[model samples]
Target: MELTPEYYDKGEYIETDTGNKVSRKSVIHGSQNIILGGKTIIQTGTVVRGDLRRSGTAHAVVIAIGKYALLASRSVVRPPSKVYKSIFSYYPIKIGDFVHIGEGSIVEAAQIGSYVQIGKNCVIGRFAIIKDCTKILDNTVIAPNCIVPSFSVYGGSPGALIEELPECWSQVMEKNAKIYYSMFTPK
Candidate 1:
């Protein structure tokens, strides 16, 4: 599907040399610990918490977002944390290329594979792994430690696998992400 052009005020965003469009209103904590791959877009009010890291680890990345990924308005990307052997530590979040995290969503997933689309107001639990070419529908709540396979559609509370996607789903999702990024223009 072709996305319509969405314009933003030129003063409201910073366009990096690598084509990353980051909104000025977004709260990105610990910038040094966050890596935004070329052509990524972070929209208004998005919060990326890169400050949370494993104990005793310095100069470690907490969030890594890949190319053409879109973090929509009001979305929150936080590192997943857990207590292991009497130690509490946060883990890194790796978001692959061409992923779209929708508005108002909160993601604490350990990994999100390429060409994935996550819908609005969803809660992706800590350490959940969403594989390539998956679509998570709106308002879903994924349970912690859940493993979502590739080419699947998941929805509902405690997000269950709804159905399998077609073989061409990766291509379709990649195209969609590209279109969305291209259409996001500065006015």
Candidate 2:
């Protein structure tokens, strides 16, 4: 897919040495605990919560987003938290390379694999595992503790496997993600 150019005010963003572009308007808490793996774009109004952590852990990574990932405007990326053995702790969120999270989505997934595309206004439930090369359509609500398989398409409330993707899905997703990144320009 080819994305149109998205223009932004140069002063509204900061480009890191590794080519990650982060919007100043984004709310990123505990920045030291969040890692962007170069060439990622964090758009305006996005909230990345890295402040929530396991009790007694002083310096732990809460969110790790991989290279060429895109977090669209108004999206929220938060670590999933749960009570286990009477202990409540927030687990880390691992987003893989070439992933694209669409606008207004809220993600609290344990792991999101590479080359995945999550459409607008989606809710990824806590501790949900989304495998590689999958697509979650817009307005979908994934159930907690769900495991989405690789090369599948999921949609609707309590997101179910809609269909299986072709072998070329990975290549297509990768290409689209790169194009989207390249087209996000300062004007």
lDDT of each: 0.94, 0.94
lDDT of 1 by residue, 8-114 (tens): 99999999999999999999998999999999999999999999998664699889999999999999999999999999999999999999999999999999999
The weakest ten consecutive residues by lDDT in model 2 span 52-61
Off by over 4 Å in 2: none
**Where does model 1 exceed 4 Å of error?**
none
User: 7-115, model 2: which lDDT tens digit per residue?
Assistant: 9999999999999999999999999899999999999999999998887657888899999999999999999999999988899999999999999999999999999
lDDT score, candidate 2, position 9: 99
TM-score of each: 0.97, 0.97
**Model 1, residue pairs in steric clash:** none
